[model samples]
Target chain A: MTGGRLAVRKTYKLFIGGAFPRSESGRTLELEGYNVARASRKDAREAVVAARKAFGGWSAATAYNRGQVLYRLAETMETRAGAFAAACTGRREVARAIDRVVWYAGWADKLAQVLGSANPVAGPYFNFTIPEPTGVVAIIAPTEPALDGLVARLAPAVVGGNAVIILASDDHPLAAIELAEAVATSDVPGGVVNVLTGLRSELAPVLAAHMDVNAIDVTGADGDVAALEVLAAENVKRVVRAREDRSPWEIASFMELKTVWHPIGR
Target chain B: MTDLQKRGDRSPVPTDWTYAPAPESTDIVRLQERYGLYVGGEWLETKDQFTTIAPRDESPLAEVGQASEADVQNAVAAAREAFKSWSKLPATERAKYLFRIARILAERSREFAVLESLNGGKPIKESRDVDLPLAAAHFFYYAGWADKLEYAYPNRSPKPLGVAGQIIPWNFPLLMLAWKIAPALACGNTVVLKPAETTPLTALLFADVCRQAEVPPGVVNIVTGDGSTGAHLVRSEGIGKVAFTGSTEVGKAIQRELAGRDISLTLELGGKAANIVFEDCALDQAVEGIVNGIYFNQGHVCCAGSRLLVQESIHDQLVRKLKRRMSTLRVGDPLDKNTDVGAINSKAQLDRITELVQAGTDEGAELYQPPCRLPEKGWWFAPTVFTNVAQSHRIAQEEIFGPVLSVLTFRTPDEAVEKANNTMYGLSAGIWTEKGSRILWMADRLRAGVVWGNTFNRFDPASPFGGYKESGFGREGGRHGLEAYLRFE
Candidate 1:
């Protein structure tokens, strides 16, 4: 309009079950001259159902296969780095986010070695501790460093075979939906990465209480950390509050250790 | 109808004469009329007392101090107070203490072995050969890790959590005690241990060993009581961690009780392990393993192979051999050296086994209990196996925690795995096969925590053991076991 040309505009929607869908509640919030999907509790629940349904296949996917899909997502995100930069106010944030996914991609296969090992359990038994994904994880992305923070929460979880349902930043959610657009094209399986753009205050509590959900990463809920933690106890979902460090342990935090002791002898 | 008269398979009676009774003399196991709680490295007065009866004859072996909530609080406080100095001690010094405990356990082996059999109703042979030896081995293994935590999880700075509240089961009292206390002490955490009411004697005896080893006062305390005392300790404030080995029912209540708390928990709960016998397995060895799997510990093992999933091809042959082998199993005095099966742990447990066995018959499954005579004085269950058992049978699904086995058949590897993982409890499994590839393939698919190939009911200190899903979480033993007692930065 500034240059006397017709500018194309996009409508932001929630990512559920591999497709961009309008909120089931048909609610939208007017922010920065854009119609952002004001995701409803029902929408969050649907995403979770879709996520729980997808957990088995995604978690059962080979580590190499998961790493490849994540790498493809990074490639897709890199192509739209400029759009993400504009949404988050910096290109560096988008780059860090891309690098973070790549970093996590390298960790998919190596994590078991770093986190699990065979035990010489002083008998004629062959024992091993294998780290398996801790089912569906509900992630609340922190508001500020929007793009980087979102990637930071998403990568570590799925890298260890866990499926995630991430609630995008309320104001700066355009980048996440754009990332979701790439997720649609990327080999990341449907429902593996479900993103909803909504008020963290409105969505997080319901997700926290969802019994089917295995863990709640509440780094985003700065205001409702205590409430989320208490709500998580309903099903004893593993709760991770604002984490300062980002390592394989973060991946491990969402992984359950399964030790097998088999007797070995004639 | 009588068990023998009602069976589908007419198991050939063992015409051979039974072995002469080889009872281990209880003379060495001297008992006191009353034993108090071992709190702060010394025996203390208790408000109440309960008699711990031997299951072999329902005879009161000793009266143990019944620890109340107040007693549990005192133990936790003692453990918490000891943590400050204990955690500050040099690693080498801590290792020395563990070494001392291990040495003392070895010296008092016979005393512990005899008392273990008398108190827990396990066969004397098992107490001496399996229980006491493994208990001492647990101490020895954890003792080596005292100075080596840094190397164990390289690059990670390992630090001990404060006081650990440990609750052990009746099945392997002192051994479970060693599994809990050794790891906690080695990690620099003090402990408040509650031994099961049925088998509190060996733990009390272990306390004497701890005192003799000169372990710091309040570093290790043994409080004996029933479920309520354990509930108090589980809910008690200021406990850094809780490690429990018991039934799945109690484990869940504890999980719900500790929900949202920062305290760490490691639960070794119930299991309905599937012992899959393949067509290619060494038939004779597999039969011996199968009998040992269920008959050992009177089938009181959490990791006991309660379900026998024999391959359809070898189903008849295996069942005939199993029935014959089970018949030869001498179920009599727990103190008897020749006994293959012992007492059924407690009256309540015996009733449970009886009720389930009745259900198996009521459900139209063929019940084939051996013709061996059980002692009239004690809670006894003959070595029993139920054939033609469906997947829906309660005996097939539930943890009988007794010498009851449900036989099911599978046509393929996938079917075997599907049936094996059908239970809510995934503590352990047994796979008998000659094919190495099949063993690995089946091991990968089975959901159980521990998988035994060609053998069953084997445990070691270095092995990390716990269940998947409701078999409970967190591991006990090995380097992974250390995670339960430590807080990593």
Candidate 2:
């Protein structure tokens, strides 16, 4: 038993409302003789519909419930480690991706504490500021270290109870689709995570400027930073600039300040 | 003449004269009817049309489809139809489309920049360095928002406001398109975009880019024409929201047009931005801001620092330095790599700028110009700065959309804020301060959409940008930017 090696199977499909399916577009992109899945603009829109459907219930969930779901998602991702690792070119990268999930999973319960604090206003009222999750986040996954970078960028957002529309790296998007499958099996709600794999240049602007999306993560772009910043300003979507040297502790990038005021008399 | 000689000695001129390449132009008739108006994933043609001319030399650039009343009706109808289903889509999936669009825009950035310069009469360096990159970045930045609205404005549920009618100015044509269109799309609202009349070619090219990205038709409908088409789109009953970037007069007109109507409006209108220099500020940095403020885009910007408010203590010193700087400002063909100032956007804009410069001289203000030759055929203006300008002067009150700076002096910080806020427009303002607390204090009091501390005219997608008061309402960057496109659920 100690000498034997375990074999794992990999499945790549579009994730919509926590369900895995062949793209509604029924499209597949080819990379290195492997069939990578893709979703059409319509499929992408459908994913958005699915996330919108799940938004109320998922967003309405208690913090405890959201944390539990995120924790369970991390656990499920751990079990699919072999598949994800195989999808990547190296084991070190896959390990980092799995570690990223766990790191962010822990953040589900702790983000409010780390990114938020009680605000001492000039007035005499109970005011405490906490961090909240933006609803649906559109992400451009890193182009180079596909799986690890994608996971690192996405986990903080989803763990915070935000749904995600991620245009996975076109060159090596299979890992992202496979991760979507893992998320489906996990306790994450339906439409909580949607992954689109195709030409990123073709897909990013649609996501960047989609009115329904709340924030954009441009950490995956390999080109001009200024132009991307300007485009993101169109609807004033919160943008997270891509940083190659940042670490997992950079989870604060997905956090937003939320001030809550209540009457002390109550 | 003695004052000019005195001012020349204090500030030295910049010696750099390198310029960038110009864009090639094609016949307008060939481009007009051939392109389809993108609406709801369908390419449709309009019965009405208009021709666009290059402002550089009065040459035809492109003939664009003028959205017929019927075409506008159909596009809005499609947007309304899509809104039912599209708005209902999960925020995450909506985000995917935006991400996809961002990616596509990045791939075709070079082509967009070249086309933008060719159509808009902007320099190739500006189109490449400032406009195209920012245009693509706008998409990338907003793409991430598809699924993140909840966190943007906490407590309240953010929703899509359906179709957005977006009209962009010609100053930074493609960049403005990104500014108006990206967040609208990200928020799940379909759009009918109108590029300026003088610069419709790049926008038409963007339509091609949208098609390549497979952006569903009716999702982005581009109808290119002048103010009439824009007025039609703004007043159209089908549009739920309107976003415009243009002159203050036009913005007020648009505001009146939407009054009493159930429409959300975001106006990024004209600005007479003040670039204030204090005695304590860094001279080199302030000089750079001065040049960048008024010289970038050949001062065709609404937010260009047309008013240079220098501290009375530093007035003589700064003016002397500025005149020396002005002497080296290369004024020539926009296509020449050696030219610092490019061609003016249009004859109308040129006439307006020249008229204002003339008015400054007519008033008590003394005019100063560095030795520079103006292009004969095309619309052009040398970088001119007026001194001894009073706050009450027309040159100080009105926006001169050209490479001209009006110099004035303020005795105190209160005066700086008072003079800065005196204008009807409040798009942007710049303060040169060494003290951190003073920067914060001034930023709090400034009514402008954007306040630049230490630096001027800097922009980021993460940082919210927009104006207050008559300059405009609503924001165009960061999380505040999304509010214009989203509805509260």
Candidate 3:
């Protein structure tokens, strides 16, 4: 058996509805002698459905519960640190990606306090501005620092209570697939975070034009952000274009500021 | 319940309840021949003109200037010119101007309230109690924020975006103007605001408020017009930001027009808000919320709860109670202090509501109207409710923008969320449940920007307001509101 020298290769399948499934069209692309499922508009469509289905449950989770779930994601990612390190450009990037997840996990419970307000209106009323998740955010993940960039875009949206359907980096796909593996093992609910890897061009437009999608994060659309923004405007989807700072405001950009007024009385 | 019962034989008969004629006097509001555009702290000359007629009685209130292209250009230029001094002023000084405006509005509150009811066709009680007070509160709220922008959004310095172009709707005309102008002024941005053609008087009166407060020249300008004039101002030169509160159709059009432009836009548009009544709700209060949700402003509110989703267990009881509560609502003259529901804002809006109500009837839904008499001449729609309304019915799907509620039943919490968020518009929603956990769950699931736990149609100045989806974007009212008019470094 030792002399047989059998070969075992990894199959990079798209993650949807918490299941690793091959492309519906059975399309494949070979990058550096690796077989990767080529995600189609249909796959993006399926991810959006899954994300939308998961949105109600995931967004309804208490902030503390969500924070714990996201922190669990960081723990799972740490256990698979070696795998992520092998797939990514460096061990430092994977380590930083884990740290970034921890960063967002901490923000899950605290960001609301930072972003929300108890407004003082001149009336017999209790007024509040609470940041709520804009549902089913479709994100186009960044190319450079594949593992870290992908984590940066994914964390804030989910931390703020949105379900995400992200198009993984077209140039560097292996790290994203590894990250998806860690996500499946984490406490994140099925369909809460769906990762599809393939042609960004074919998928981004469909996601942008998707009526079910409430927002589009074109932070990694490369040159297609302007076009995607216009398409998003067709359905009035909130468009968060590529920007550097991953501040709390980045999460606020994907969140709806809901101001509630209740009459002050017994 | 209290209003009618206090009068005597608290029988639920609609014919028995006759409200005393408590008409608010309109003698206080003085009108001009042709009110030209307010630009650079003065009335600018304009050739084009149109008459602003009262929707309650169809009498000409004033001959308002129809802003020409040149007039739009002048307004933008004036705002741009003032932006220099406005942005350079100290935050405390800026706060003073807003405080002055708020105080002036309060001192002359009754006059403004009367003008608002006459021009917008809202009940005098609402104009006085809701619109006028909220308008003053908006300016007052923003005035405090003017000097404290640094504390509002921690860890950042907020810089004012120059020369905002604002356009408001006919519903709560003065209130919408306050929502638009107050925040922009607080953030140190000079504004060129356009009031809706149907109701420009209160805003033109606001221009007078600016003068009385001695706000610097060109700091605030009011350009009156229909949609075309609004279009010109939107595309006008030197407009760095645009804020509009109107119908979603116009909001999307404006979004398309402003796409890829550097200008930032905040749209407060239409809604088909779902008023969800779960099994455990306080049924009587739920009935009151249902009536207030749809019948308020004659259902002209963008955040109005027009879709009623009652739990199947409470369906019959809730509908019966809602119908009874609606029957008590007095609908007639806008100036009448006793009126609960008033005339439709325009003939076009009234016709639209009529056509949609007809579609509901055609779609096999049961229609109910209280046997109340509307004023003889003006545009009016009775407080209407459709029972057995399918989620796909036209009345359920469209924003009729009049006093109409579509009643549908849901058996489960999941189904209720599904039906509530079924509309393309997600402006506001109401959840009526006594359970603490369920309210949190429902508020989480409901897609609306503003979710009322047990109340409906409640608004406050400090409370940021807007929508989630096709109901439009950006917020106006709190710290989030200032971001619409400020550029962050």
TM-score of each: 0.90, 0.62, 0.92
Per-residue lDDT, model 1, residue A233, is 55
Residue-wise lDDT of candidate 2 within B267-377, one digit each (tens)?
Answer: 777789888788998887788889989988899888788899999998888888888988887776554445567889888888998899999999988988898877667
Tens digits of per-residue lDDT, candidate 3, B158-243, equal 88989999999999899999999999999999999999999999999998999899999999999998899999988887899989
Worst 10 residues of 1 chain B by lDDT: B1-10
Sort by lDDT, top down from the best: 3, 1, 2
Query: What fraction of the true interface does each of the listed models get right, in terms of native contacts kept?
Result: 0.37, 0.00, 0.70
The candidate 1 chain A region of ten consecutive residues with least summed lDDT is: A236-245
Superposed on all Cα atoms, the candidates' RMSDs to the truth, in angstroms, are 5.3, 21.2, 4.3
Q: Candidate 2's interface RMSD, please?
A: 15.3
Q: Could you tell me which residue pairs clash in candidate 1?
A: A121-B462, A121-B463, A261-B450, A262-B451, A263-B452, B22-B337
CA deviation > 4 Å runs, candidate 1: A1-9, A23-57, A86-90, A121-126, A140-145, A167-176, A196-244, A260-266, B1-16
Point to the candidate with the largest DockQ.
Answer: 3
The 10-residue segment with the lowest total lDDT in model 3 chain A: A239-248
Error of 2 at B78 (Å): 2.1
Ranking by DockQ: 3, 1, 2
Best by TM-score: 3
